[model samples]
Target: MTTLKTESPFIALSGVSKTYRTGNESLPIFTNLDMTIQGGDFVAVMGPSGSGKSTLLNLLAGIDHADTGDIQIAGQRLDHMGEAARAAWRAHHLGIVFQFYNLLPMLTAAENVELPLLLKPIPASVRRERVAKVLDLVGLGGRGKQNPTRMSGGQQQRVSIARAIVADPSLLLCDEPTGDLDRKSADDVLAMLGYLNRELGKTIVMVTHDPEAANAANRTLHLDKGVFVENEQVAA
Candidate 1:
């Protein structure tokens, strides 16, 4: 396994541009955008609807491509890698949580949390231990036997988070993770994210429109028409 250099920035985007075309029309979302996220940094991106916040997240996560420029994560150039290579790279290095829980309905909480580890060759006993540890980290240890339908939205989201972190990915990407929850549930999810960043030294990049959600991050960057307009650092 290749280990990421701790001194290097976890993610870097330089002169990146993304463009899309429709019938007789061309649209460029971001042109020559430059961004860098250091290791252990919890960064928030905020933008209006259709401002390309989600697109930016997708690009970072290897789910989408940019038309031009460079993208490097953990010292690997993602733009030069093929689809299968990128997918494999992401499996080993990136953890993502989306707006929807995206949990497997038929699986129990423990099973859902263990989904990522299934890709690895670790022993069954080791996998079970990792699952238990991560579920407990997310405060869902007791609910491991429950199915998604039996759990609250918050609990389900915690299970989703446990699934993401169980593999010990180098970076975490969250796209409106709290968008589907109530205020209290949203707070719980956000607090868990903060705890992961602080306690586990996980690097996180989150896209959200909620001001309070942005406030939870160590630093917030505003996106306008796909470009970074403002960056504010919060006091710890």
Candidate 2:
């Protein structure tokens, strides 16, 4: 995880560009986009469909390659790293939350949380400890033995979050994390995110369509045609 306390930008992107080639046409998403995100800052991205908001998140998370420019996070240059190195970096430094929760149907909440640690060389005892700690963090300590399929949508999402943070990643990338929930459940998840940001010093970048979700963050940026059109701060 990140032990970065120095005040340099936690994430930086400069001259970034990405394009996709389809059957006959080439789609240009964005070009020469620059962004800086600091540690512990909760930032949200909002845009119309097909505006490349999720694509931008994919680029930042290193899940997709940018056609041009550079991306650096926590002083590490991501664009220049090899695939294996990037995977290792991502595994250790980032936690990603998805709208669907993505919890395995067959696994218990604790087992799902323990899955990420299986990639590491840690002892079983340590892995269990980490899983328990994160489960507690996500307010799912008692649901460790519960199957996600048997839990409510909100409970399942919390389990998903526990899995993400079980590795104690420094940065969290959420894509429509509250999109699949009802208003009450969405509020619960958003409040959990806010607590994580304010208490753990985790830097977060989220892509969301809900204005209420965006409002939960410290700042919101609107994207269009791959460019940020508005950047505003909201009091949390």
Candidate 3:
């Protein structure tokens, strides 16, 4: 397995906390949590409902900020970055896969994957080539012209994966990616994720409730009420 250099942290969180307030009620999800994820690491986060797994994922992705603590990714301090800067950073460095396959119905598979690259200044020819390469990598090369509605759930999710990785982001964040799929479809997606980690040396952090999904990762971390409670290393 490829490993990150010991001196650099791909993702780090220190003393992180999140709280919500409503009608004089205060809810504290987790407190004093610290984590460091290195490049090329495939880590899974698992917990029961309301355990703050989703919150942690959001914080790492820069969708939400912690009440107190620090977050740094790929040498950038996300906690201090402006919203626009964070968004730009995410666009260029992170690939996100949500639980639902959020494909644009009006766009074909290739077009959906090409959306990210559209933000860059690359020539049209180069962008198209990159799109085709990633689509082929995800095993959807010939299906590029098909509308997502015509595809199976598994195929649509593969297109979503293709879209996420089209920019060749170094970090891949998946939030319950297989939650809506059947066992076979889930397995297919997991296989693709594993392949991405092994073949592309991408750092992956997935939030999932399924033990089987967690098993696919190289390491598993348990989050409880916004705190990281356990870390387990899976055998290769």
Candidate 4:
């Protein structure tokens, strides 16, 4: 088992809280959320329905605002960053994978994977080379020309991972990445995620409901109404 490190945290969340207001009622999702993820660590968060898994991911990614708290990732504070700054920060420092494999249907797999790099000021030739390299790294070298819809679930997810890592971001956030796949496809995606964590040394924070998927992480934390009820290290 990999033991918890005493080093400085790569991702830190202190006193984070979130709530949603319906038309008539205010509902609290999670409160006083404190977490610290070390560099090169893979952590999984599991929770039942309505337990704020997606919300937490959004908060960590700087896509959503927390009611109260601080989020410091890769040494940058996200809780107070403006929208444009947060977008820029995310582009340079974070990689995110979604459950739906959010590839543009109109674009080919290579095109979809190349989207992130396009934001940078790199030359066209360099962009092309990087797109080719990342596609091949995710085992989609020849399949880059294929439409993502034509690929299997596992292959599409692989393309997503390729897209996420092309920038070499320090933090990788995955939200229910296996939610749309079958058992075999999910297993393949999980294996690819594991490879990213172990081989590429990405500090990953994944939100999953599947116990098997959670087991792939170095540690698993269980979230309930407002806090973590369990934090257990998984056997490597």
Q: lDDT, candidate 1, residue 218?
A: 94
lDDT of each: 0.89, 0.88, 0.88, 0.87
lDDT of 3 at 229: 68
For residues 1-236, write the lDDT of model 1, one tens digit per residue.
12333687789999999988898899989999899988888999998987889989999999999999999998999999999999899888899998889999999999998988998999999999999898888898777889987888888889989988999997889999999999999999999999888888888999999999999999888899988876566647
Clashing pairs in 2: none
Model 2 per-residue lDDT tens digits across residues 1-236: 44444488889999998999999999999899999888878999899998999988888788899989999998999899888998999899888899999988889989998988998999999999888888888888777898889998888888888887878888999999999999999999999999888888778899999999999999898899888887566664
Report the candidate with higher lDDT, 2 versus 3: 3
The deviation in Å at residue 62 for candidate 2 is 0.9
- Model 2 lDDT, full chain set: 0.88
In angstroms, the error of model 2 at 137 is 1.7
Predicted structure 1, TM vs. truth: 0.95
Q: What are the runs in model 2 whose C-alpha is more than 4 Å off?
A: 1-3, 234-236
Candidate 3 structure lDDT: 0.88
Best by lDDT: 1
Residue 188 deviation, candidate 4, in Å?
A: 1.6
Per-prediction TM-score, please? 0.95, 0.96, 0.95, 0.94
RMSD of each: 1.9, 1.4, 1.9, 3.0
